[model samples]
Target: MRAIAYFKQNDIHFSSDLPEPRIGADDEVLIDVSWCGVCGTDLHEYLDGPIFMPKDGETNPLSGKQLPQPLGHEFSGVVAEVGPKVTKVKVGDHVVVEASLGCLDTHRWPKTRLSCTQDKPCGACRKGFTNCCEHNGFTGLGVVGGAFAEKVVAGERHCIKVSPDLPLDVAALVEPLSVSWHALRSAGFQKGMTACILGAGPIGLTTIAALKGAGAKKIVVSELAQIRRDFAQSIGAEVFDPTAHGTNAAEVLKKMSGDDDGFDFAFDCSGVKATFDMGLAFTTFHGVCVNVAIWGHKPVDYYPMLVTCKEKILTGSIGYTTLDFESVVNALQNGDIPLDDCKKLISGKYTLEDGWEKGFMQLMHHKDKCIKILLTPNNHGELKSAK
Candidate 1:
């Protein structure tokens, strides 16, 4: 199996001879990966990490693993093998993986259906919020070998089948799309409501798609990058160039809304202090502001009076639930989301061998031009052009 593994901070290497994973339990499923999307988290680990890669001489408390781990979580594939007890999917089925690894003892399996027999459940899991389970661990980051290789072994509960007609490359986006879907659900989004997204990166773009699918009356996206702003507009979002607006982006959003009421929901996907403040300021009184980006360890400073004066609902969303994954799959399959436009998000593709230079570094340097870069174990070809 060929894989990209993290050995230390600022180091990830492609290994052609990595051992192939096997199904170790009755509930496990082995997938022959077709496409894996490189994520911001992977970039974070590559540039300044050991953040989720587990430090040297230490083990992840959830998975009992250490460094030299595979690096990909957003992926889709065909089922190559399934344990005897796995009934959710069969061999040759097209599927996407939900890589969040919740505590086995307290977390329920098949979260989409919410079936559980545990006498006591974790605080979050008990409330159907498994994404926030007290002992959450991401499979690709450390808990299990990821889809960076030819074969990935994951629990059946984490695998969701997609329409065979769905392009495998586009299917790889289910994981990230679910992240935005969960954020919308967390903010109590509803039809006819106005929302603003504070970034035009992958997550921000997906948030726009999700908001559109949810029938938001007005969708405003604020971004500094012209390429991203154009991409957002192509998908029917009214975009604002933050660089042009300077510190008045919030006021601009309010003016665009035609009333000073502000957006019903505002999302901060940029993970910066300034964007966070803008999201808060753009949200209407009594409306919700959802933090969808992971800030790592960086601290943010904001006026407490912002929340106090407006009676705003300030909340943060982590990973997505199984339902979110299922929702995205259905949206793609049923045409609620425009497939052609959604395909534009996949800006590049590379083989496992070229993932470091052409994939990760492309995002690291030319982020304005690259959106979601997919790395395949089998396809070593030219980069896919954006639609």
Candidate 2:
């Protein structure tokens, strides 16, 4: 089986003859991947090396898997085979795999308490939100193999059935959209409130769609990139180009709405320090500010005083839980969010054979022009150009 593997930190070495994934247990299902979305975390690993991923000699205590793991996770595919115990889904069913592996610690909630390797019952799992389980480990980020290849083996608990009406190519977007669902849920967005989203990247754009579906009174998107700004506008968001305006972003939003009254809620998806600050600066007093971005380095001036003074609720949201996935899938089915436009977020595409330096490098260097770039694997010795 052909797949993209990380031979070392920051190096993407493709192997055309990698061994195909095999089912390790009766609860697992083997999937033939149709499309996999290239995530920003993947690009970060390509340039900055492994940070979120497990290091050498480190293992996921639950799955007992080692490091230098497989890459792609945002994926959609069909059931190639299923273990005898996997009776919920049948062979040849189209499905999207939840790439997350949780800690299974419901009481530990969001923290990864399972790092201690204890035998405690997770609190989050006890509440039926096992996706945030601190006792279990992530599948794609922690496991050795993920959906980056021709075939991937995921536990049956992670598989979600998709209607045939959803195109296979577009189904790969469900995972990322699920993240947007989780963000809104964590922020507690309401129908009559206004929201200002920082950074109009893929996640930010998806959040706009989610907010619209949830009936947000007004949705404003701040983006420096013109292309992304245009896309946000096309999707009914009041788009603002911070760079072009030359005014303070927070001030601009207040002025446009005719008051110093800040935004009801602000979300940061860019992970940049500037955006995080903007999210805080623009939020209305007693409002909520959610940091949806994943960061490596600590940014300067995180404004603890402002949060205290304004009595604002500041929080951070990680990946999606199972409920988030259900919400996203339902929104897609109801046409609350346009799946057709979600496919347009694909800024670039590559085959697995494109190699690391070329395929992954294109994503890293071309941020302005790229949104969600994907790498398709040519299984069964089928090789074709991806121009």
Candidate 3:
């Protein structure tokens, strides 16, 4: 199997000898890769990482898997094979993977060191918050070889079957969209609410589509990049550039909520000090502010009074669960989220053989001009028509 693999930090590349995955458990599923998306986290691993991929010599805590694994998590594919107990999907079904691995997943890898040394489910998982598991990991990051390869084996529980009517390329976007959907759900976002999303990057753009599907009354995307702002606008969001308003930017954006108070919800998709401050400052009394972005080790100064003064709620959302994937897929299929708008995020497509140079490298060097770039193994005959 050929795949873009992570050997160590800064050593990721395309390899033709990566071992092909197979269904190892009764609930396992083998998928023939159709399309996979290059994610920001993948770039982070190639640059400053070992963040999610285990360190140079360390193994993943949950799966006990080491580095040199394939690098991709956001993906869609056709089922190739399934374990006897895998009833959720069958061969030929098109699906998108949920991708998270946690304490609950230890049973699937019964021979793992953790399974033998520490088998208890994490407190978060016991409480039904598997996303916050103490040893949370993802399939592509380290739990197993990922979708960057020609084939991937995911647990049936992690695979969400989608309508065959949905293009596999568009189905690949569901993983990122599920992240935002989980964030909004965590924040208690409601239909007809005015929301402000900070940033228009890949995750930010998906946040807009999630909001659209969830029925936001007014979506205001604040971004510094003109092109990203335009991308948000094209997805039916009202775009805002805070640089023009100086210190009063938050107040100005609040007025756009139409309440003259503040946005009912504020999402910080760009994990920067500016957006952090703006998310807290621009939300209404009793409003919710959700942090969906992954921040670096550096900490930002916090003022409890900001939220205390107005009774505003501040929370953070991490990875998604199966529910988010199911919801996003249903939204895309039911006409709540326009397929064309979802397709708009795809700026480029490349074969897996050239994905490292043409897909990942393109985003690394010229990211501002790109939104989402997808890679394919070219296994599906539909590629001729799908392309």
Best by TM-score: 3
lDDT of 3 by residue, 1-387 (tens): 899889987899898998888777789999998899999999988888888888888887777677789989999999999999988999999999999988777767754666422256768888778898777889899879888989999988889999999999999999999999999988788999989999999988899999999999999999999988988999899999989998889889988999978889988999999999999988989989899988878999989999999999989999999999999999999989899998888887788887888888888998998888888887553332111
Name the runs in model 3 displaced over 4 angstroms.
115-119, 379-387
Q: All models: lDDT?
A: 0.84, 0.73, 0.88
> Residue-wise lDDT of candidate 2 within 128-174, one digit each (tens)?
66656665455556554776788888878788888878776667788
Q: Find the number of clashing residue pairs for candidate 3.
A: 0
RMSD of each: 3.9, 4.2, 2.2
Q: Model 3 reaches what TM-score against the true structure?
A: 0.96
Best by lDDT: 3
Write down the TM-score of every candidate.
Answer: 0.91, 0.87, 0.96
lDDT of 3: 0.88
Minimal lDDT window, size 10, model 3 = 378-387
Worst 10 residues of 2 by lDDT: 104-113
lDDT of 1 by residue, 206-291 (tens): 99888887888999898888888999998899989877776676788777755588888889988888888888877889889899
